[model samples]
Target chain A: MNKKIGKHTVRLESKPRIISVTSVVGPKEGEGNLKDYFDIILRDDLNGKESFEKAESDMMYTAVLESIKKARLTEEQIDFLLAGDLLNQLTSSSFAARGMNIPFLGLYGACSTMTESLGVAAMIMDGGFANYVVAATSSHFAAAERQFRYPLEFGNQRPPTAQWTVTGAGAMVLGKEGNYPYITHVTIGKVKDYGINDPNNMGAAMAPAAVSTIYQHFNDTKRTPNYYDLIVTGDLGKYGKEITEKLLKEYGYNIRENYIDCGEEIFDCETQGTNAGGSGCGCSAVVYTGYIYKNMLSGKFKRVLLISTGALLSTTSSLQGESIPGIAHAVSIEYGKIGEKK
Target chain B: MNKKIGKHTVRLESKPRIISVTSVVGPKEGEGNLKDYFDIILRDDLNGKESFEKAESDMMYTAVLESIKKARLTEEQIDFLLAGDLLNQLTSSSFAARGMNIPFLGLYGACSTMTESLGVAAMIMDGGFANYVVAATSSHFAAAERQFRYPLEFGNQRPPTAQWTVTGAGAMVLGKEGNYPYITHVTIGKVKDYGINDPNNMGAAMAPAAVSTIYQHFNDTKRTPNYYDLIVTGDLGKYGKEITEKLLKEYGYNIRENYIDCGEEIFDCETQGTNAGGSGCGCSAVVYTGYIYKNMLSGKFKRVLLISTGALLSTTSSLQGESIPGIAHAVSIEYGKIGEKK
Candidate 1:
């Protein structure tokens, strides 16, 4: 039985294992801090595709296949593919699913899709819906720029608080039986809006949501900041990470000692000219699949809480002067001894 | 346990019950064929909101609240809210979730969102992840028009194959315990594309997917068309309905006698000048909640197969000359005796 924790949290009786993970990144991200951890790095953002959109779909496709291959599982062994991207209609995920031929559930949580997919995949596996499932997400700078902001050709000047959308894709193969780093708990989030309307300052806009979810996760699980080796947030970037920490403090939790943001960790904002940091569905995606998962396997991080945050706003909504609504989902993964039972 | 039967189908042992459902539509849909079945009908599309987008959000808000009220459950009793819309960033669902303060998982399946959400919500309930979950989706004429096609100000001449987007919102509350109309099976879909690129003819684009899912559902469950009193396709409209029948015939399963489309049933295309028919997330949403669900309660239909189809194409992809990929999900609902067990 899946145990229901305090509120908004589910503690699985049979934890789902992260059997295999893979990350693919463009040249910019390849040159970032976690370059060595990425599986494949493209020479350019387009990755030889004619369009950025195609490149994004192709990247997700490659990541899914690569993750399955790394898991030593054939395509037929994977029962479902849950994926999403930062595109209208989730074109990247749908187009990618066209080739894979797996049953697909297209999700849209903007940047938080990584954790959202993971949580759903975990639940599906824990509930015995499937033996194995793949969760993947991707985002591209050019594709996101044209869709959410000015087109690449426009050469519009970005504000200081603006974070560059990462050109990357990440995929994880989750299964009922595997080694360490099992997903133990999941906390789905409620949307929170604090009247922030600036599209460029997404980190600040999404900070409150990250804070809200993290607080809830702690409250639901009766755990504190010291419970995990690290508490990582997805794509809150530098400013948003600071805001989240401040808000968490206000909520009577001090996580600053063992906390980091994937957005800030992915790029050296000062040297990379990425202003605040990287912010996209792929930001936390690649970082987790590449750096975090590998470290967990090596026993460098015994336990971790991964929370991916998203700002739910469209170009039309932003243009119409609506405040950005943010959401975040948290998943707790712990290192277990091989063949150990919970 | 969730039993995997044929290729893409799952037989849920713990069938989730549809406790309550509500539909809200604009004046156009209110004046259509299923007008009497709707819970609330707005006199105007804007619903006194300043913009069509806000109106869309507000419509979803009202439908969700009305459904919860009809379910006789407080907001705190609902475990999760699974929602989606035809908007770019799922603005309506996310905005509504912000106000509802429920844990939300935003999905994007275009028109198929109605069944997609219900299927996931049922799985969540059956999986013991939650006791009660709400599934909701909305679409608006002006909102979808400006986002997908020409703005309302453009006044572009409509093509004969073009279907009018429905201006409506529908919400259903699914719980572990209820009286009747239990969801017994769910079929997740694979993305299928036959090189169709015309976004205006969405029904034609989505017909193949609907046929594929319905065929698989029959094969997996080992039941023919006679198993259900009604086999309904979400919003294939007139042209797509014909295509679906032809495709089903090719598959050697004749469903023409028992088949009806929510799109075609909701509107008199000839008199309403809705071209082929209605096609939007809300087309199937309002039709299911207002017409089919109400009729089922009255025992007009004892068993039904509801398959909602979606043409997965974004404005960016369509502009870039990518073919529209389509998907469909099927759910089996039966009129169970009160307190009956499987």
Candidate 2:
């Protein structure tokens, strides 16, 4: 008995529970601040694969299996797998699903895929359509660069505004109901374009979208930022996080104190040599499923608003002189049983 | 309330009604077998756009507005829009969704996008999470050719097994419940790769997926193919359709008498100079929304199973020596009333 709240938000009455989760990342991410949270840390980017693309898919496959095992369930018991990645035609997810034999639904929300997959998984569970399903997403540094920018052989210098693409994957096992963190609501975002065209400055392009969804979520849920312990944005690096904060303030919300961008949280920008911070589909996914999940389970956090932002653009669109459009989907995860806010 | 049937099928209790639909096609498709069924046919492929990609996006935008207007709905009244396209990062869908403020969920199922969108839309509506939502998909011939194969100006010779990409879009408005045709069941498919590596022979690559899903649907529902007035494979073309028929027969189900492939139905292959048939996200979309919708409204096709098959590979994946993985999603649309399958 879920209800559509206002325009973009849906109040999930069933509050599907997170059964288990797994995070797999490459060596670079293994050295990040949330390193201890990951379940699998590859020694190198290739992870025994011939190419980065294959490695990215294998990372997700590992996450899927690890998460199911963590939840004490077999592949046959899982009803569906909702996954996506920042690759052309969703090759990363497609290849990963091919070996699993689970019913698959391919999703594409650019980097906002983490929440996009989670939102769909939660809704399907809340709807009583399935007892169990998995929501997962992944991205690789080398794979994304080749697909979205110049080839690796070109050795072009990245602009200062550019954020490092996280080489990682995250998977979450969601059940109909459990004592784990409850996904109580989801706010789907619209494509918001501020006419930012530079592909290197995705944070700038996606900032407005992150703000818009967060603001809409606040209004629709009839709650302020203080209602939750934290309000996190996916891959909006330090600069983009600043923009989002200012934008939200203009909309009558001041979330400055309780906000943290996953891009900034994942890496120490200055020491790590990552121009801005970590950013990609995996940036928010690993942070949420690994760091956030662990914190929530340990009662270190109560309620959290996770808004995964994405820049909706392909190299072709950029070449065709189209401005980058951004979108963000927000999911409210509260620790406790159903009807328990804290 | 929905019931999970057997392994992969869902029996939707609400039976969300199809409120309205629209189909848009280009000049080439307009001259095809189902010419009269299209809602809007462009005089040329460009449709006044600067490029085929933009034209494809605009065509879908037209379908979105046309379907909404046909249902007497304003964009504001629409709760969500689920859309996808056979473009990188879903550029066509993302751009089309940008102009509309409706909250969007981007899907990527290659050619299977049409049914993927419909299945999610139906579930959300049946769950009472959305009062009205739209499911849409699209593809463009020139755009696809340049992206997937050679440049349009390359003048590459087409192989006999090659299918022409369709220049079209299809959109449908789904509501909570009404007297319209009911969406009662959906069988989400797994990725099936039979190691078909030839990019030109997508029919062979996707046929196994089509058959696997259809056979699974029949088995899970405990019903034979005769229960439906028509059973359509999205765009498996002539050869794929034959393979699907032969494969289903081995599974103890015969659907030859009432079976048709959208790819085969969309164009007169021999006359149109299309080697295999029409195959793209738009192929099944236009065929279903244009041809099937008209026939159903005219008291034909009472019960139908629409399985949209997708070849889940990108040019990058192919170049990286990967085989084409395929997935098919099946949805059951029954006419007249909820309890009346006939």
Best DockQ goes to which candidate?
2
Per-residue C-alpha lDDT of model 2 across residues A1-342, encoded as one tens digit per residue: 448997899988888889899999889889989899888899999998999999999999999989999999999999999999999999999999999979999999999999999998998988888999999999999999888886779998977789999999999999865689889899999999999998889999999999989999999999999999989999989889999999899999999989999999998778888888999999999999889999999998899999999999998899999999999999999996556545
lDDT of 1 by residue, B135-239 (tens): 999999999998899999999998888989999999999988758688989999888899888887888899889988999899989999988999998888888
Model 1 DockQ, alpha carbons vs. true complex: 0.78
Clashing pairs in 1: none
Q: How do all models score by TM-score?
A: 0.98, 0.99
- Model 1 spans with C-alpha error above 4 angstroms: A338-342, B338-342
Question: Which candidate's lDDT is highest?
Answer: 2
